[model samples]
Target: MSARLYVGLMSGTSMDGIDCALARCDERGTTLLATYEHPIPPATKQRIVEISRPGDNEIERMGALDRELGHLFAKATLSLLSKEQVPSTEICAIGSHGQTIRHHPPSSHQPSEQGFTLQIGDPNTIAQSTGITTVADFRRRDIAVGGEGAPLAPAFHAAAFAKAGHTRAIVNIGGIANVSLLHSEGQVLGFDTGPGNTLLDHWINRQLGQAYDKDGQWSAAGSIRPDLLARLLEHDYLSQSGPRSTGKEVFNLAWLDECLADLSSPATPQEVQSTLAEFSAESIARGIAQCEVPVSEVYVCGGGARNSDLMRRLAAKLGTATLETTASLGIEPEWVEAAAFAWLAWRSMAQLAGNIPAVTGAQEEVILGGIYPGARPRTQ
Candidate 1:
């Protein structure tokens, strides 16, 4: 049988860039063919952050961003193909997760109502620009079936990391942190642990004008002020159970300011950043302990994994040896999310159910993603 190829594109909460991955997948499994990261233009990034929580002009700006991002995503794919020498026609489809603006999980008052989630990207434009069939909007169906419609990485994590006898937790420390706990008994549990680098990133950027902590060097140079850490953890979301989700809506710069106000001594901005990193490590460790299943090891991924201070804090708090990344297990950390969309697209094409009912709380298994055919001829 010939190899089947698909391109996967992901723009995570970090608002860092567009990650594109080409994969060869078959009945056996999937393998990464080529991967590239296309940074979001500074202006575009600022626009996205502004519209994340929009006003009356939201509709107009959202439409514009969708088209803009679609073209950027297509460009990323084309660039990858050129660098890898792969013909576009060789790929079966392009799976784009788009950009998530909002995620509202089902609540007690609205038990009967399905949760709502939104991702904006013009799939039609992506197809037209790349000449490859595109599959996008992979979250609504799970939400419609009563799921939280997020932390969707667990299904893919299970496929990539689930072991027969060992229990493990895959922690993705993006702008937000989420964990997928896979057990020997075949039980998989996942949810947003809380703020990861989001709060720290915003605080540092505001205080130091740096986009990120840069291996958490500044954070390492400072101390974790206990009082500030206590205040930051007071939010109710920290105590929330699994199947819960959160984003910038609940944990943004404003939230940080409120927490900061409760502090008596004004520590240096670097110290505050250190405290925030500790907050992330503590929250993640606490969340993992709450899981019913035992986790023998923690595999860290996403941009956060590269931060030495963050990883050191995480290992110390969790009392587990930190593993390198999914790459060590044959899948690169950067490509994990992108590869997931590729898997989702393949499942959609096969008409197979993708979402895990237990993880998402969906009423039942459902096939995720909507397909957009390219203008070119379809291959049999």
Candidate 2:
């Protein structure tokens, strides 16, 4: 059977850029076809960061940014197809993960009868601009049915990487870190580990005006501040022992400033950067350790896999189970999330369920994402 083509667009919490991936999806599995990276305009990124936190006129700011992002995502999809010399008509659909602004899952600490998670990048605009069906708004349905509605990637990860007789942990360190514990016995477990690159990226931008620390060199150069690391590690979220999810709403610059407020001595920029890396590494390691099955090997993905210093720290914290990029398993670290979204789009189009209840703590598995049909071809 000929494989169907699909496009996946993802703009993670880092707010760096949009990742557009082309994949050939079928019953056998999904195969990545082509990929493109479109930088998010600095102004647009700043606007997104601003509205992520509590602010006045949120409706206005968010409404505008959503349409802006939709145009960008459409441009990214068209750009990818043009570069590959392919026609948009050939693509089955576009899976747009959109930009997540706030995600508040129902929990004992913060109970909500009407829990909601919002991601915006107008799928209508995407469909109109690209003339291709778009699948988006993927998380809220799971949330509506009494689930975390975040960390939806684990279900895709489990499907892509699990192998019989071996247990593997897929750790994706985006703005926030999450791990998929894949067991040979077909049990899949996952949750957010807290604070990946968001703190590091914010600190560097504040102190050095750089988007992010290159290879985590600045962080590696400084010594870890024991007190700061301990305090950050003690965050209440880290102590929780069940399904969880978080985003910029809970781990932004404001949260970091609050953590530093009680410190006896203010830490230098470099020290704080180092502590952030250590904190992320420790939180990831701790999450992996808590899995019901011992992971014999841990595969890293997302932008974090490219940070050498962070990888070194992760290795030191893991201490034995091989730590390597997802490339070892035939998937490049950077493209895994985008590819997963492509697969999700395939699932959506096939009318198959996408969310995994075991991973998201949902009452049942459900098909995620709302579909917007492509426009009809022009007549002669």
Backbone clash count, each prediction separately:
0, 0
Model 2 clash tally, residue pairs: 0
lDDT scores of the candidates, listed in order: 0.84, 0.88
- Candidate 1 lDDT over 173-283, as tens digits, reads 898999888887889988888999998889888988988999999998998898998888888998877677778888888888888887787878888899999999998
On residues 1-380, what C-alpha lDDT tens digit does candidate 2 reach at each position?
A: 23399999999999778988999987788888889999888889889878888899999999999999888999899889889888887889999999998888886335536667889999999998899999999998898788889789988887788888988999999999999998878888899999889899999999999989989999999999998988897788899876888877777788889888879999999999999999999999999998776778999999999999999999998767899999998889999999999999999999988888877778988899999997762111
Which candidate number has the best lDDT? 2
> What are the RMSDs of all candidates, in order?
2.3, 1.8
Model 1 CA deviation exceeding 4 Å by range = 1-3, 108-114, 320-322, 377-380
TM-score of 1: 0.95
lDDT of 2: 0.88
